[model samples]
Target: MKNKKKIILIVIAVMMGIFLISGMLKGKSTVEGLVGDPKGTFVNVGKAVTTDIQTKISATGTVKAEESEIVFAEANTKVETFLVEVGDPVKKGDVLLTYDVETKEGLQRDLEKLDLQMETARIALSQLQAGSKQSIMQVQTEIASIDKNLLDVEDGIRQLETSLVIAQKDLEQVEKTYDVTKTLFDEGLAAEKELDDAEKAVMKTKDQVSSLETQVASSKKNIETITMQKSNAQYNLDLLQNKVQDETKAQNIAMKQNEIASLVLQKESVLEQLDKVEEKVLAPIDGVVSRVGAKEGSFVAPGAELMTIINPEKLVVEAEISPYYAAQLETGLTVKVKYNGSTTVETEGTISMVSPVAVQKAAQDKGAVSTAIPVKVAIDNSQGLKEGLTVDLKVVTSEVKGVVAVPLLATMTDKEDNNYLFVVEAGNTLSKRMVKQGAADNHLVQVSDIEDGDIVVTNPTEALEAGMSVSYMLLEEVGE
Candidate 1:
């Protein structure tokens, strides 16, 4: 009976020792956490693993062709010919169409007529510039002839005056003689034959005076007619000279300029007409015609989009990042892009632009902190993309490799704006450690105070405090 009691006491002591060891193991703590039974106050936990962490923001955008342009015809005309068809490749300055001669013939004729008129006007102007010097000479000669004629008229007038004067004097003398003779005859102091002779002499003198008067009148009329003729010639010469100086020359110069302007307009019009006459649709760039809206003989107007061309060679994936995350984005940052349907076909790109403004989809929605900013990702392998394709873009705004970081849940902020972490020390108790924090993308924050194997508490609560006796469990093991 003594031997059995001693054995039982030994077993009891051993059981007590086992319990103590177990309790000691459960309470003992390390930087990571206390090594304990898998259950205490059961709480989910995460590890502060060394990982190459990347800060990213995601947005939705469509693939756009790099070079897209719209072409239009300028003139108001119908399509006359089509030199190429849809999907046909075209170069710069290639003629797209040719117009029917019938339609343009009328314009051509009108232009020709204008050309003739313009040329005639130019010739007339030239003639004016020459100033009818030959004609002027002829006029001067005629003027000289008129001057001579006028001089002759003046001379004749002078001669007629002199003749009139002479005739008047003779008549006076003859009258006196006749009066004396008649007085003698009436006194019968003279012979009857002598009286008869005196009568005849008086009659002859009177007739001679009448004849001289008629001759003078005729000479005066001749002079007056010659003078009138000279004046008419001078008037005609002046009219001709004025025509050469003013009307014909000026008209010709004006007409030449008009013709030049018209020719220029016609050239432009022809080009415009040829452009409108084109019906062939060609690829705007070295691109794939992704869409064809109209076909041959289709009636279209300006600004009407007929087809869509996508230059897969130049593609960009546009993304709309939230304003909150956009502040971290910048140009020339690397990006990872994945098509919505084909996530496996991944491509790399670079950030081309970061908008400074924030955007919101709905009026009532909370505006994104960087909502107004447009984040463009220039895809390197743009040839693999198509227009209107949706892509998922992950822009690596920042990254840290092998830095001491804690899960965001492990951190707590107090009213004093102090950021701290509850780190497991000795005896399953958490010690609050104030840490200088670095960048935090979202759920992870970088800390300089923590080391590679430091134990940080996850899911911190108010009940947790410094130097408090707390039971804990190991949620995750440290990874290399």
Candidate 2:
């Protein structure tokens, strides 16, 4: 029992010495310096510095011409010949192609048909005018003859009236003579034969007066008939005059004139079309032809695209950006463009437009489709840019200068949802700093309540606590 107790004491002493040596080594290792500390949690660190921080959105883009146009066919016709090919440089008004001969001939026939119709309308109008004049002259002649007959009937009635007046006086004289002869016969101083003769004379005068009155009445009737005929003829002349000036004949003339005018307009339109089909198609602008849609014998409909032209001097870069940056993307933002080719070309640009709506993009990973907004950047100098070339674009969304910033990794969130960072304090201790984050990029974040040159733990661990003693190496010294 005594020997077992002595062996137990020896083991206890050995164990105590081992524990003391381990503790001393661990204490020695925790000393702060350029070398790392083993007792403290191993972490990466960065310095809070005053520097400019820019937030950028990266995207791939395609170079495109800002001025591009597609020339189209103006009429339904077949292309007879192509005067220009793809990649051909052309000036405004230069001939690009020609139409088929059949089209020109068809237009010429249309023009000739219009001309013939117009000539026929003009001749019909002249014949209508001549007929109207002849009808008017006939009616005027009839009215003049009726007027002369009326005047002769009136003069005969006047002559008959004068003769009737003389016969009335003669009848009065004969009545007086017959009364005298009867008075003499009653006194038996005149003969009976003489009295009979006086009575017969009175009766003869009465008959003459009645006959003259009848003639005058007949003449008056004839005058009335002639006057009615003259009135009818005058009415016909007025009607004929109205017809020639403002009624059917005038309306017919107007209709013929309108027909002629309509034919004239049609002819002009057809002539213009004929001129176009006869001449070759001209370029509307100065550009390089990028595409030709028709061959020499191909038929094209009206408004069909014939070729595409692009002005290379005007260039822009088009890119698709995520909706996450929609609020930041807008016109007038600066952009950096890089074209990776046999020789990389670098240039500066500005955001010219941002689409208000979003478009669905194909699923790149065979997953759900994503949405992106299109943006255009106008290059300041397009010296080395070409149409349809793919390029890289860096859009500067936000920027700040002389601000206190730290690595994004240095920030942490507490249970209260406040942002805080582990800043290295004096004596190599950690102090939990509550900061107000202003702007953040992918790598750095702008923070308030953090001083410049404050060493901050960029890669903090879960076990890290505030006020804990730490042995740290400067991030710069560690080349991180």
Candidate 3:
């Protein structure tokens, strides 16, 4: 038991010793830097004076394709065949798709029908030209025949008049016989039957004479009608002959021909439509099929989309700038672009176009975002550029020449509204000097109170105080 107690006591003592040693080690490590001097000491900063200063504004942007387009089909038709797929290179006039053969053949038939219709229209137009030469000749012949018929009618009227005169004489003789027989019968010098017979014969002769007179009158009227008709026909024939002599007839014919020509032109237009209907959709430029909106057996309406063709060779980065900065930005600005884990490249671009109106960027929601108008930057062909690359844009806004400058670290600002820095004098002693500072950048600053050859202490908090002694060190050697 005594041996166990001794061993326990020894173990407890060793534990206490280890804890104390660890605490001591941690304490020494934490406080060692505060108690001792740093392995690397002060940075000696030199005063940089004003030279030519270029003012610039920085902006971040992305690259996009300079040229892009969307294509569409012309007709609503079933897609018969798709010739090319995405990424397939095509040339101008290449067939993109062939619709169903049935539809195409129908269109061809329609075109042929249009041609036939045009021919028929031409024939109809030719017929519309009135009074051809052959028709005029036939009219003249008919008029001559009518003249002969009129002469025959006049001769028939004359003969009927002569016959009427002879009939009238015969009727007069019969009337005399009837009067004589009637006188004898009244005086009892003749038989009653003889008087009656004479009276009957006279009556029959009178009726015949009356019939002949009516025939004569009818013949005269018929002759007059035929003569007038012949005169009218002759007048028509002469008028048509005169019309043939007039230049207006030719003008009429020409006018008719012009109408036919117009119809022919209309027919030609229809034929062109037919031809266009059968024409296959062809690519206009050499490019890849960037987008496909058509498939086999799909109906494409008029101006329907088929596929998009893009030329990757003509690619550029287009950027938009705000109108507020538009006055400061001009054509031919230098730019730097970086892409795909690659090193940044120096390039210059020109302002291709600028929108007069303010255009909002993607970050804009409503009313004017920064009053920035859209501006396009044209990529300089001298630099090889690819699409879809992000770029950093820097624009020089203003420039100043020969200005005094200093390192930012060397300048100090206090609550008393004074800016100053520690300067190293000739005897290696530090002195506090008030300074006036100006515009600064990531690496350089413009200082007003320091001379060109003055030495300033960067990190003045290290051990710097007014009238303190120091050793001369080059800025390069001190790693400032």
Candidate 4:
């Protein structure tokens, strides 16, 4: 029992010693924590730096293809076939799709009508050119013939008048003989039969004279008819001559040529229309079809969506900038583009344009407004860029030399739009100093009224206040 009691006493002492040692260790840790960070906070420090500062206009933007184009149906038609799919690469002049016209019957009817018109014009022109001259030539030949017949009729009339004169003189001589015979027979100086024969001779002469007169009258009538026919022929010849004059090359030939030319032109025009109606839509540029809006057999209205093509290698940023700085932006100014969610991946570009007008972002809220002007930035090297990606924009407007600069982390903002910083005094106590910030690129800004070599706390924590005790640090000492 004595040995067991001694063992219990030893165990109790050892347990008390272990508890005391643990308590002491815990107390030392509490004291160390107080010495290390009295306010349980971390202080980030940076010095007021004197350096060159560049001012930049900041904006947010989205990636756009340099040559993005939206294809639209140019006419009302049904899609015959879609030759490309979404994401398909296409070259310029490649057929994107074709149209199947619903008005095929109407088009065919129109073509037939045009064909008939052309045929009629062609036949009419040919007849005027060939048949008209032939008719005039025939009329000229007939006129010549009529003129020759008229001369013949005049000669026949002269011959008939000579015959009539000779016959009349013979009749007169015969009548004198008959009278002489009658007188002689009555005085019994001649036979009766002789007298009768003389009388018969006189009658024969009278008949001959009458028949010659009838022939002369008939010749006169024939001459008159021939003269009238000759006059009619001459009038017809004149008509033909006038027709020839009027139907010369300047008239008939030119008219025919013009008519044919007009028909040909009309035919060509209608053919072109038909070609357009049945033609395939070709790609106007080399790109990938990012979206296919119409499918095969779909009916579309004029100017409706067909597809969207975008070149992945050619990209630009359409940034919206504050209207205050928009006037300072111009083409050819350098730009820095950063991917919206990326910190390291970035590229340099140039300002392509600045919009002249400001656009409201939202409806006004009792005079408070948000508006911006569009600014375009062109990226020289656009590899790995995608359409519609968000981007951060910075346009370096001007550079300033010998300005007091510091990290943006050191700045604090108040509700009044004023900025300030916490500067450590000689005894390591912090005092607030009002600062005017000029230009900021990213993490650094040009600060006014802060002298070089002044220690400014970069990040002020909740543990800090005016005239508070703090541990000191130089950021360079920590490899930060």
Best by TM-score: 2
Best by lDDT: 2
> Between candidates 1 and 3, which one is better according to TM-score?
1
What TM-scores do the predictions have?
0.52, 0.58, 0.45, 0.46
Candidate 3, residue 185: CA error in Å? 99
lDDT of 2 by residue, 1-480 (tens): 225434544564566457446647777554344434445544557888898988899999999989988988876678989999988999999989888888878878888899899888887666556657776677677787887778788888888888889999999999999999999999998999999999999999999999999888888888778888887766556655663355755776788899899999989888776665644778889999989988888988768899998898889999999998899889999999999888999999999999989999778687779999999999999988889899999999889999999987777777887888898887677888899887777678999999998989876655689877765565656675
lDDT of 3 at 371: 47
lDDT of 3 at 65: 56
Cα-lDDT of candidate 2: 0.82
Which scores higher on TM-score, 1 or 2? 2
lDDT of 4 by residue, 1-480 (tens): 225434544564566457446546775334322222344233556788888877788788899988878988755568889999988999988999987755455556777887898788786565555557675677678778877787787788788788888888988898899999999999999999999999899989888888878887887888788778877766545544563355353475577678778878876766665665656888989999999998888887768899999888889999888878866778898898887454445898999988878898664677676988888899987765678888788888987888898876677766797878888777677888888988766567888789988887765643468777665344556343
* Model 2 pairs whose backbones collide: none
lDDT of 2 at 82: 92
Model 4 regions more than 4 Å off: 1-46, 50-58, 101-105, 110-275, 340-345, 361-370, 398-403, 407-438, 441-444, 447-452, 456-480
The superposed Cα distance between candidate 1 and the true structure at residue 18, in angstroms, equals 31
Q: Rank the models by lDDT, top first.
A: 2, 4, 1, 3
Candidate closer to the true structure by TM-score (higher is better), 2 or 4: 2
lDDT of 1 at 371: 33
Question: What does the lDDT read for residue 221 in candidate 4?
Answer: 87
The CA lDDT of each predicted structure is: 0.65, 0.82, 0.64, 0.75
lDDT of 4: 0.75
